[model samples]
Target: MVETTSHTATVRLPGSKSVTARALFLAALADGTSRLITPLEAADTVAFADGLSTLGFPVDRGGDVWSITGNPTGPPAETAVVWCHDSGTAARFLPALVSLGAGDFVIDASEQMRARPMGPLLRALGSLGVRVHAANGDRIPLRIDADGVEGGVVQVDAGASSQYLSALCLMAPGTRNGLTIEVLDEVSVPYVELTLAMMREFGVTATRQGSRITIGPGTYQARDYVIEPDASTASYFFAAAAVTGNTVTVLGLGRNSRQGDLRFATEVLSAMGCEVTVDDDRTTVTGPTHLRSPGEVVMRDISDTMMTLAAIAPYADGPVRITDVGNCRIKESDRIDAMASALDACGITVHTGADWLEITPGRPHSALVQTRADHRIAMSMSVLGIRTAGIRFDDADCVGKTFPGFHQELAGLQEAWQRG
Candidate 1:
């Protein structure tokens, strides 16, 4: 970490990856043709769209507005192999989707994503009468023998990932008798809420009572949908503002947005002494004279931003402890360890627990940060480069998983900050 400096810049981000993925899933399951305006064109989304196309769902990824012809009866292909690549969303959500069709589907992921857990979703599908087999056991490179799904009571453990539950919810409306999800344990409940909200937007009703959610048998009616800007991706820019004592305004993401990651601005950044203004259509963050520690912040619901918080924590006045995010251990990388290691390489004092990490204030010297091929790691670590001149990354291009232009955007902000 380096001494804070003042700067100001405004950034326009891509569409929400969460929303784009869910919209593609919902639209493909709709009753008619659907139009998605300004959807994210990234590696993860492209993998998702390709997965859908492989499963026999038609997707036209030509321009700003991509179109998908809905297939309420599930994928038309009787046999398909989906190459999920490194996209966890594609890996988790696609299985439940293919189960709605009468076919044999093989879901294969990249080495990184295959290491993440998938047993919960598979077990829930099995309970719902879909025959599933994981070659690696609980991980992907699994096979789904689909004859169609029957909607009844299903129990799912979403503690490891909320995508498992969201996957089920997205596919519930197409089940034969509707679906009732009994979430045994869950993390990132807000993401599940986003999934539900999108489902309702597509003309389906899903109700949640306590830990149980029920979706009745219905067909999604296609309509033109506008995707919200990605809040998770915006976090790096907001962290830039906080770290450098600058003002960074992100256009199109507001307090009213359904993305749970937006709370990073309202909750985490605000707690860390940043002046946060969340309007209906935009969010702005201005850093303090110097950063202050918010102490312990439980980031289970917004765990995706945990890396952002950790990267900037060493700049604060005191130690910052982020807890309740054990799920961080299983993201695109073992984020808790990865962030701890990167901070250590920066010569910062850090400690770790099973699920938490604490960063003690120190001057983070420039170091060669190992990105582990995780996009968040690369982007979060890049924020340090704003102050630490010699900071570098081994695989910065991993940000292409979401924002391919991250390096350029941060460079622009750094230039503006320097000129001032």
Candidate 2:
């Protein structure tokens, strides 16, 4: 079992995996080369590498360097089916690229991915003249025959996953007639903005008018792009500071980040009575005597930070109610259930519903946390472990799926405690 202790420390998070994946997909369609800095080297990114390789794009990954040579002309023949594993980004983004191919390609995933919904994206693809068939009725192992795409006006339900809308927008400019996307009840609007920002960086412009988005026919121009630090991952350190009454500085991020999760720093730190300052590329958070739990918070935009918030609940003075997070149910793990189970095991009072989590602040308890093969679960639980007397985590290796440097960062913080 890995052991950790609470301490005052500063650390930097890796580049946003969500941004890296989207930027790589867009760069692969660009006319030139693109360079990404501090890119996340994890399972999800590896899945994207495999998918891009199958699509005829050359991707090289070593240490912290990721190089991509895009195929602006289009992908080669799909002689084999691509396995996207459990990565929803790969599953959604690659399907749109496959629509430009001349042959049939079948995209399949693990059991967990199959359990996740794909109907919204499939329906939108069908409207764009791509033939898609799902095995077991609207699930994974989707077969795609992409002779050509018409690409006029397409309506997609954005309720389940914003990736569906993102996939369509990224591939819109490549189509013969461009595309217009009408979104119905869209969640995670910030992620959609991230997608549009990345698309524009690659020389494709998209206009968002309320629930509708329009993209014109254009070609992507290859350029060097730097991915910002992951704000979602940074939330853990911010919470650590709040829980331990320490001051922590998170570097390599900004106030103007396209990542929606960046908002979590402001919301969480402010709510916890921390002094926060955001500069061009860093944020500093100073913890107060105790955190004040607002009655309820709408987390639809920053759902990724739910795990981090749950970890800090034990230090709050009152109950923390998280709402508008229905999308969390379909993440790598059912985050709502995973968080509730882990926190409850740690002797925290947790009330859970389909889309909400209400946590009552109390004393920390010793327990073993099961990560459910989810990176966020592992990181959040580890942070909580630092405050508890004795906390063991199952499957600690899950942190490598996103932040490979997590263990090292924890070690540095623990060293500070020992020295003090």
Candidate 3:
């Protein structure tokens, strides 16, 4: 049994991998050398680096520093096979960018990656005169044959994943002509905003009017950029203080973040009876006397933090319901089932459906959780394990997929036994 105790701790989160990868890709397409500070060095970012390298982008790394030479005129290389592993952002974004090259290029990944839907993206690309083939339905291991993108009007379903829309937008400027994207049933709209905001920082403009976005054919101007702290990773530490009745402050993230998951701190503090103060560069969360369950929270905007919500659910006084998150079913794993199953194993009754999860707090029970090789699952289970008596996580090393220092960060909060 690995015994752990709850304690007060303040932690600083790494830069957002989501933002870093997009910024890196844009920088690679810029006109000159781009400098990115506080960038995440996780597997996903590494995969993005590999994809750029395969396409002839010059990338140099030293310690926590990174430099990318822009290839605004396009790469000198031809089509080649690029593997994105299970990184959806890499898989989705790379395909559109590769369309700028000539020849047949294939993007492949793990079995789980192959299961994630890519039909919406494929259909949208096809509408823009790009040919794509999915070895298994509309999933990964996608093959793309591109001479170049013929820009025109394209319609896409934004309900599935915002990455699809963002990918198209990123590739729009490199097309033969400008492109206009009409979205149908948009969800997780904040992520799209983040993408557009980053594009503007790189000298590309994407105008979002209602559900439609128009991108003009232009070159990306390379410039020095600094990635902001990851809001998703910040949620775990914030939740720690909220659940354990302690004071914890997360540095490098604040009110003016382009990342939408930053809003999670406000929602969590509001629900768990904590006082939240957001300043220019930091956010402090102070726990209350007792945490109360805010039953039925609509989490459409903050869907990425659903796992953190599940981790804190066991501490709530009553049933905690999470809704408007059907998109969770299509992430790195089927988060809906994975969360309910993990919580159920811990002696909690979880009422779950296609799009909602209802968790009732009860006595903590020890159980080994299967993380399904998902980074968020592994992180969430580890956080919950802090409050449990005997907890073991299978594939705990899967945290390297995103946050490589996750275990070390958890160790800072409390003592945990590591088994070989």
lDDT of 3 by residue, 275-380 (tens): 7888898888876667778878888888989999888888878888999899999998999899999988888899999899999887668999989988998888
TM-scores for all predictions? 0.98, 0.95, 0.95
lDDT of each: 0.92, 0.81, 0.82
Candidate 1 runs further than 4 Å off: 1-5, 418-420
In model 1, state the lDDT of residue 162. 97
Candidate 3, lDDT over the whole model: 0.82
lDDT of 2 by residue, 1-420 (tens): 122333455677778889988988887877777776678777788888788887777777765767787766456655558888878888888889888767888898888788887888988898777889987767888998877576899999988788899999988888888898888878888999999988887887799988889998888887777777888888888777776666777888878788888777787668777778888888887777767786688988888898888888877778989998989998889999999999999889899998999999888789888888888998988788767877777888878767877867875765664565
Give me the runs in candidate 2 sitting further than 4 Å from their true place: 1-8, 417-420
Poorest 10 consecutive residues by lDDT, candidate 3: 1-10
Better of 1 and 3 by TM-score: 1
- Give candidate 1's total backbone clashes: 1
Worst ten in a row by lDDT for model 1: 1-10
* TM-score winner, 1 or 2: 1
